[model samples]
Target: MPSPAPWLYWALLSALFAALTAIFAKVGVKGVDSDLATLIRTVVVLLPLSAFVWLAGKWSNPTALSSKALIFLGLSGLATGASWICYFRALKLGEASKVAPVDKLSLVLIAFFAVVFLGERPAGREWLGIALISVGVIVMATKR
Candidate 1:
């Protein structure tokens, strides 16, 4: 059998870590202020990421990036911070299974955004997959 693509490997790792994040966050937020929990988590992530960039000699000259790139990256970071705050708050109040599935609804939005903003046209089968994901999320999110 042929090896999977590099992107597939990375994506699988992402999924694994995301699952862990939901589980861990669900537990960590218990009896804690959700915003404070998010702050602590952000610190944990920042410390390791900073160490990795510095120790691995992967640091880049921020000035070299174009203004547009910088602006977009800044906006993306803000969006991420907002998302983390909301996610932690939700996990504090809801079951991880249901919360995680609702969060995955972003996948459907990503597919639409990629086509509309990135001009990337997915094949018909890909659209079918997106539709299924949409339906699955609805099913998973609904109460019995």
Candidate 2:
């Protein structure tokens, strides 16, 4: 059989690291303010990401980018900052297992957003999987 796509491998690795991130953040945010913790986490991520881009010789002049690119990236950055702040707060207040599963609801939302905004048509099986994920998140997040 053919091997899975490189993106799948990288995405699985991301999932593993994300799990660790939630666990570590839960412990790290114990006494710290969630917002402050998010700030520190951002610094840690920024330094390494900056170094990686430079070392990979992929760094480019930001000002040379098209206005459209800049605007989308700026908006994406804002959304990421908000998500991290809220995620940290949730981690600080709830169990990682519960919080993280609830957070996967973003996957369902992504499917909807992609269809609406990106005009992507997912196959029936894929839509079924997304529906199951939505149901799972709702089931896990609600009280019995």
Q: State every prediction's TM-score relative to the real structure.
A: 0.96, 0.95
Q: Residue 24: error of model 1 in Å?
A: 0.4
Worst 10 residues of 1 by lDDT: 135-144
* Range of the 10 consecutive residues with the lowest summed lDDT in candidate 2: 135-144
Query: Against the true structure, candidate 1 has what lDDT?
Result: 0.95
> Model-by-model lDDT, in order?
0.95, 0.94
- Regions more than 4 Å wrong, model 2: none
lDDT of 1 by residue, 17-136 (tens): 999999999999999999999999999999999999999999999999999999999999998999999999999999999999999999999999999999999999999999999999
Q: How does residue 71 of candidate 1 score in lDDT?
A: 99
- Enumerate residue pairs that collide in model 2: none
